[model samples]
Target: MQKFGNATIEILKDETLSKNWYHLRNITYNYTNSKGETKTLKREAYDRGNGATILLYDPKIDSVILVRQFRVPTYVNGYHGWLLETPAGLLDGDNPADAIAREVMEETGYKLRDTRFLFKSFMSPGSVTEVLHFFAAIVDATDRVEEGGGAAHEDEDIEVVVIPLADAMKMIEDGDICDGKTIMLLQWAALNRASLTQ
Candidate 1:
C-alpha cells in the first residue's frame, strides 16, 4: 500500500499463522510517521475472504426476516451463544450478490428476485481483514419455497425469525439484537422505509 495522507506503510513480512477453513496471517509492517520516524508493528489478521449479508423485508407486512443461531465466539465472550442476525456468508469466489442470494436461500428459505446494494464495511478492521457487502431485498409470501436451516454438511442449525420492523428496532435497544451488521441494516431500513417500500 502507498502512503496515505500523513502516514506511509511498507510491508516487512507476511507469514501464515494458520490455514484451515480460512487463513490467518501475521503481518509485520513499517510505518513512517509524519515526522519521518519509522516504526515497526506486528499484527495478526484473520482472512476469511470477503462476505455478503442481506436483510429481507416485506413492505406489505412491514416485517423483516432474520436468523438465529449459536455463535461460539459470542458464547465464549460471556453472552448467550445464540445470535439474531441477517443471512450472510463468505463470497467464496462468487460475486457478492450471488453469494448473498445463496446464503439467504440456504438460511432463510427465501429466493430473492431483486436485491439492492446498500454499502460495504469492515466489521472488525483492527484485527480482521474482512469486508462485508451489505444488501437489502424486498420479498413477499411467494418467495419461500423450502424450509431452510443451512446445509447439513455445513453443520449450520439456524432458526428463521420474521418480526415487525418496529419490534426489531426495539430489540436493538433491549440488547436482544447485537450483531453489528444486522444493527446497521435495521437502522437503514427504519430510516428509508418509505422509499424502500416503494
Candidate 2:
C-alpha cells in the first residue's frame, strides 16, 4: 500500500442530506503525493463509497424485475429520462445482504426471499469507490400493483417494471439497459438462470 497527498476540507462547499442517499464532507485532498515521491498519479479526490444492488426475480413466472426511473444525472447530460436498472441501493450500513434485500423490497415492493449471492465488485473503479453486491432475489409479484417503492424518505420514486429474463437480455443489446449493476446481474443470470429459476 502507498500513501499520497492528504488534505482536509476547510469547509464543505455543498452539503446534501437525505434519509437514505446522502453526501457528507467535501474533504478535498490534493491526492498528489505523500511523504515519499511516486512515479505515477491519477485522479484527485472525490466521492467514493460502497453500495449494493439486487436483480429481484419471481420464480413463479420465471420473470425478472427491474426498475425504470428518471435519473437526474443522466437527464442532465443526455439520453432518455428513464434508466433501466435493478432494484439497488447503497450499503449505507455495511451489511451487504441485508442492505441489498432492503433495497429490493423498498424499490420494488416485493418482499425478497432467498437472496442468492451473485457478485461483489466496484462500479466505477476509475474515480468512484462505489462497490456493489449483486443478487438474484426471489420476490412475490402477485401483488406488485400495490407494493412499489419505499417510503418518501428513501428518495426513491421508482416505477417497477417486470419482464422476462430473456427480454432483459435483449434490452442490453438494444441499448435499453445501460447501468452497470443491471448488466452484471443479467450476465450472472444468463449463466445460472436455469438452476436459479425457482
Candidate 3:
C-alpha cells in the first residue's frame, strides 16, 4: 500500500503510561494536513487489543439472548452499573469466531454454531485501539448445556436475559439497552429479520 494524498505523519515520542491488563501509550506526533499545515499533538491511547461480539438470536421464536453485568465505566458515568449487552470479550489471540463462541458459552451458557459474520467496527476510535468484529448466530434450547453466569475465575458475574426481538427494540427506545454494540446488533437484526429467520 502507498500513502495517499500529500499529508504526512511523524511520531515525535511514544511513552507507556500503563500496562496492567492491557497497555496505555501516550504518543506525540506531528501531522501535516493536506493543506501543508503541520500540527503537533499529544494523545493517550488505550490498547486493549481487539475483541469480538455476537448476538445470539433464535429466529424460530423471534427472541434474542443477552447478558447483564456491572460495568465500572458506566457506573462512574452516572448510569446504573449493570448494563444489558450482547456476549463479547477480548479475542485473546483467538480468531473472532472462536473468541465469540467461547465468550458466548462462558457468558450465556449457549454453544454457538454457524456464526455469520456481520461487520467490524471501532467502538471508540478516538482513544481506544479496539476493533470489534461483529457476528450473529442462531441458537435454540438444545444448545444450552449449563447455567452460564460468566467465568467465576475471571470475576464475571453475568445474568442471562432472553426476550422477544420486539421487546429488545423497545428496550432500546426506552433507554434500557444502552450498550453501543448491543444496539447496533439489534438494529441489524431488525433490518434483516426475514433473511435471518431463514
Q: Largest lDDT belongs to which candidate?
A: 1
In order of appearance, the predictions have TM-scores of: 0.97, 0.76, 0.96
| Model 1 regions more than 4 Å off | none
lDDT of 1 by residue, 1-198 (tens): 669888899999999989997899999999999988999999999999999999899998999999999999999999999999999999989999999989999998999999999999999999889999999999998999989999889999999999999999999999999999999999999999987877
What are the per-residue Cα lDDT tens digits for candidate 2 across 1-198? 324245222222333332244333323222334433323332323354677788776767777888888888788789877898988777777588888767766787776557788668866666455677777766665545447665587476788888988888999999989887788888888888777865
Candidate RMSDs in order: 0.9, 5.5, 1.4
RMSD of 1: 0.9
Better of 1 and 2 by TM-score: 1
User: Sorted by TM-score, highest first, which candidate order results?
Assistant: 1, 3, 2
Task: State the TM-score for model 1.
Answer: 0.97
**Model 2 residue 130 lDDT?**
68
Model 3: per-residue Cα lDDT over 1-198, one tens digit each: 123498888889999999998899999988888998989999999999999999899977899999999999999999988999999999999999999999999999998768999999999999999999999999998899989999999999999999999999999999999999999999999999887867
Please estimate how well model 2 matches the true structure, expressed as its whole-model Cα lDDT.
0.70
Better lDDT candidate (2, 3): 3
Candidates sorted by lDDT, best first: 1, 3, 2
Whole-model lDDT per candidate: 0.94, 0.70, 0.93
